[model samples]
Target: MRRFFYTIDSDNADAPLLPKLSELSQGSDIELPDSIIHHWCRVLRANVGDQGILFDGFGGEYQVQLQTISKKKAIATLLLHLDDDRTAPIISKIGLVMSRGERMDYAIQKATELGVTAIQLLSSHHGEVNLKPAQVEKKLAHWQQVAIAACEQCGLNRPPLILAPLSIRDWLAPTESPNNKTAVSPIVSTLSKDKYYQVLESAADLRLQMSVPAAGQPAKPEILETVLKQESPYIELLIGPEGGLSDDECQKAESVGFAPWQIGTRVLRTETVPVVALTTLLALYSYNK
Candidate 1:
């Protein structure tokens, strides 16, 4: 069976009335979203009685069977609920500096597959891309959709939230709270309200900055060893752009309690940092067990 993300849009009158997937009951027939209709009905040529999976990013997924199909509309009947979130063992939020073109998409896509809880888009002094006011909405939506699509492909039931872009200075400001309403993603703000997604709003248990490999730096941050000892630890990772963070930006991040984490002797591209960093943590986690 094919899996599809059932995104919520409370602001739209035609959107589903229920915000969370858990609210939907078995044996109920529900209208499919436009995105799903296009992919499953028209493009895939799915017919009535075809079965598939639907997830709303609240928690679990549902087994559904197509009941109706039309050019612009489709309906599926919920058969059963599968309570498998398939989330990563650790909760993480990566403060990723924007890159250009496919690099940005690759970062978000791979991060979602690795079970990142949230991503905070940052524009640093050495960053490649910075969105203007007009570009923010479109770009943010595009990135969020990228994460959603990754979830559909990777069997991650709960999609990671892609936050709105903020400057490195503003994001690291002592007075700035991570939960500030201004930084909320437009796609998630008005849609589902899950407690799991709210975890990123709070301060993380550990904060690590992916620093360029420098001589005399510890191979692994001591704090990482300490944090992973706890159950389901929450970590915040800072990854810079292609050229890496400026001296001042790095110093500011250090002042804000971000410990330097140099993975290996080799230098990594901006897009590759997330994948390597996440897998390293997972490896460490398994070794500790």
Candidate 2:
């Protein structure tokens, strides 16, 4: 069946309320938001009896049939709740240095499609783009929308959490308590050697450094594969912007336990690294299983 997925904004209480997956049963009528109604009626030219899927972003999804369609609103009747879990077994978070325009948007979309659990926008010394406080708020919302759109298209019921942009220094700052947040393996892309060995030795979680190596140097996918074998439930990948991380920034990351690692021999663009790295990690995960 052609499954069209729509995400319900649980935060928007003003919208028509839909039953939770646990409370949902067959033959219950539910009203879809006007935005979804417009897409179905105006964009897709869906008829009254068209069928699609609805996900609340909690987990799982529902089979729904369009029972009523009009210029103002549309209603669907919930048929069944499919308890399929589509979440990735390994949680991946990408800490990306802000890039220009569509490049950042593309990274967020593709990363969500690759099943990243969260995205942290970071500012680096070498990054080309800078945002004021207002711009940060706006960009955070924009990137979040991009993630949601990616989820709707890619069959991900849960979208990655989009964090507000922070400077690289602030991002690496130690929190007062480690138990306050979920544990994550920290991997960073760098070429620094000063603290590399120490970071690797002390790393309790999987840490990666992605770099394009010099000629005759071996690729480190094998190293990344070995780290993945450690089976950390969550990993946070750090990729730099434009010119990549500066020397000082690399040192700071290493101080925070971000082990550096390289991918292939060729340099990947700022936006391209997330897609390539995520695909490699996900592929390695499946291969190991």
Candidate 3:
């Protein structure tokens, strides 16, 4: 079934009276985004008295009846507070190096569709395009459109948060948030003097960038799984560019204690590692689920 979710203003309580009146009651007026208005009002042929889902994050979904309609305006009133059917357990987040051209777009779309909760774009030393503020804003807007399109197609009602543009270095530095949020860095590795991976870490769990070699001639998957077992409490993937991390960058990462382990006998593309890492952890986490 096609599913859509929206938040309703609690001050308006007429939504709950829909079923009793047998007519949709138009309540709070919300400004629908242009693209959505086109689709919902025109393409979907959604008219007054039609049903949809609306809710607060309070865990119950409000079954709503569409109350009013016009060329560019519509509203839905809450009907029944139905419990949600699906649940997403994994709190997956990706920290990606900005790839050039359409590849970055493709990665973000795929990653969001795959259920990433947040997407953080990082500019690494190996990044190909240097951005001015305007350029970054332009790209972020495009990226958000891509995410919304993915949500529409993938049935993801809750859109993932797209973080502000940041560099690998600046993103790693500690700072205060308006919400009184604590410092959070996701990328981690095993300790190794040679391989560079640790451009990101947290004070509580500082050992994220190390790669652990297996006890025997283990499979690549097996080695990664064993290594993740020793993960320092959190897992934030740090993916480098096509040319890979620079020697100096790698050395700097290593100085902060990144464990560099081999993924395979062959080299993976810039976009491939993070995808694999996401799937791998999801699979591992699913086993316990």
Candidate 4:
């Protein structure tokens, strides 16, 4: 049974129809475009009367029956809108400072697959993907498509938001964008300069940093032990760029109440750390969920 997430606005409660929300249904007529028609006819090899599931992201899943198999488009009659209830647990958030080339793509894809509630792009001193506003739009579209494909492949019903990009200095400052729309406040930011807290699933919030271990500082702590012993709802995760975060930024994050955690001794590629950290956090988050 292949599941496809879609949006449709038909009043019929008997059968979940194909999403003609974009093309037809001005007053009850349903239609589809050639692109989608070709997808069903040629790619899926679907014939008239084939049945499949459709979801409109709003917790409603529908079953539709293929009705019209036109040469240019395929149309479906909606039958029923069943409730779909598989959304990821709301862990904190993950913000990755952008890096060059395919690594950024890889990071976004894996982060979505790992069930992150939201992903924030970071503009840092060592950042990549620096472009004009127009170019930014193109990149954003590309990243969003990556996220969508990830959701399709991973079977996560609720799509996580890829928010408008952010600057490290601005993000580290007192105010930030609201990742949660329905919340009373837009974001978790405040006017006062306070510790930037990002709640992730892991108890031990880790930041991939520039400093390596010296000879004798204690590795784990009592606080981490206590939290790890039970479970934590939110965590903070920071992954630096190719060159890693500067000393000043790390000090700033530390001053703002972030704990320093190291996964291992070897340096992980910028993109790899988030996948590792996020997947680790997902394990912990799922346990609590």
Candidate 5:
């Protein structure tokens, strides 16, 4: 299927440009935004009568056929709405401490492909990169774009939400009581002595003690299996920066019910950790289903 991604603009309420194609009908004339026209006509070299798919990133997608092509805008006739749900059964959110340059971009892209529900960018004591307030806004917008592009490529109907950057301490702070909230299995990738730890269904809300062990501990795949058996569908994952989380940071996370778990025998880069971790969890969840 030929699909294109667009973001909704708040200014134009009636025809909110490329992304929000709300008023679609079988024989209706839909005007494509300049950006969409450029990409579809100029970049993709799409001609009249070519079939195309459009998604607003809200949910599902639309099938259309190009009727007219021009430099100003292209027009397409809506065929039908697709109610396809491409979301994963499990709701996983990754708290990633920001890494430098393309590493952060790559991590966000891969994590979106793995079907994470949301990505919470974090700052930590041991984090190498620090961004100003202005820079944070720019980075957030950039990363959101990256996620949308990834979803378009991966056939994900809904792109994961990209939250603004916040400190790890603040992000992990207790908001409500566990009894009041749904049970969330918190997992942290850390250097721990117990490399072969298994997560039991009974220990769904267990708080694990933090321990520093040598690097190169292999990840236990059964942990994911145990998590999938739990009543709650949510999983909160914490991955540190290049230098990894400080001892204090680990303790703080442990205090908040995050269990320290190792992913591989050798240490993986900050960007590689989320991709590996999310892939393992999603694969196991899919297999069990």
Candidate 6:
């Protein structure tokens, strides 16, 4: 069976007949999202009785069977709901600097596959890509779609929220108290509206920066082991750009409680940091548990 992300456009009158997943029941008909129609109906040439999986960025996925197909529209019937949760044992949001072209996409894709809770897109002193005011919406949409496609391929039911890009300085500024809860990302708030996704807005239990390998830096942060002991520990990671964060930026990050985490002696490219750092974290989490 193929998989499709069921998107709802509450403001669009032409949205699918079943706009909300709550409206779905076994044997009930659901008008497939437009994106799915193009890929499944026209491109794949799907036929009646074809089965596929569907997830709405909620907690679980659904098994559906195509009942009707056309050049412009398609319909599927919900077969069953699978309540399997494959989220990471530790909750994480990477403050990833935006790189150019495929590098950015690759980082987001790998992060999604690793069950990241969210990605806070950042523009650092040496970051390459900076969206103009006119470009923000388009780029955000493109990146969000990138995350959605990654979820479809990786079997992650809850797509990590791709937050709007922010300056590293602003992102590091302590706006909220450690105990204060911040507001959810506008993107997730508009599309998801789920309590599960809201957890990303809360203060992280531990914060780490993927620091450049230096002689004196510890291989890993000391607090990481203690933090991973908690149930569903929320961690925030700061990864710099290719040229890396300036000395001033690094200082600010440290002042705000981001412990320096040096992976190894070799320097890693901006795109590779997330994969290596996340894999290391997952390994540590599994071993500690």
Question: Which structure among the candidates has the greatest TM-score?
Answer: 1
- Summarize candidate 5's per-residue lDDT along 112-169 as a digit string, tens digits: 8888777778889989777896686567768877887898788887677677777777
Question: 3 or 4, which is superior by TM-score?
Answer: 4
Task: For candidate 5, list the clashing residue pairs, or say none.
Answer: 216-265
Better of 3 and 6 by TM-score: 6
Task: Tell how far residue 154 is off in model 1, in angstroms.
Answer: 0.4
Better of 1 and 2 by lDDT: 1
lDDT of each: 0.86, 0.69, 0.52, 0.57, 0.68, 0.83
The predicted structure with the larger TM-score, 5 or 6, is: 6
Tell me the lDDT of candidate 1: 0.86
Clash counts for the predictions, in order: 0, 5, 18, 13, 1, 0
lDDT of 1 by residue, 1-289 (tens): 8999887764475754654667777898888888899889888899899999998877789999999887778888999999886999999999999999899999999999999988989999888898999998889889998998898899998888888888888888837765544455555664436688667768899999999999887888887877887778899999999999999999999999999999889999999999999999988887777
Model 6 lDDT, residue 91, Cα: 88
In candidate 1, position 59 carries an lDDT of 76
Considering every candidate listed, which one attains the maximal lDDT? 1
Better of 2 and 3 by lDDT: 2
Sequence-dependent TM-score of model 1: 0.94
**Per-residue error at 187 for model 5, in Å?**
30
Over 1-289, each residue of candidate 4 has an lDDT whose tens digit, in order, gives 4455453322234544444333323233245544345555678888877876654344445567778786676677766655555554435466678887788889888888877666667777777656665666567656765775686677765555565566665655534545522111111112001122233222434332323343453343335443533443454566678877777887877766566666667777888877777665556545545
Better of 3 and 4 by lDDT: 4
- Each model's Cα RMSD: 2.0, 8.0, 9.9, 8.3, 8.9, 3.1
* Superposed model 6: Cα runs more than 4 Å off: 10-18, 174-189
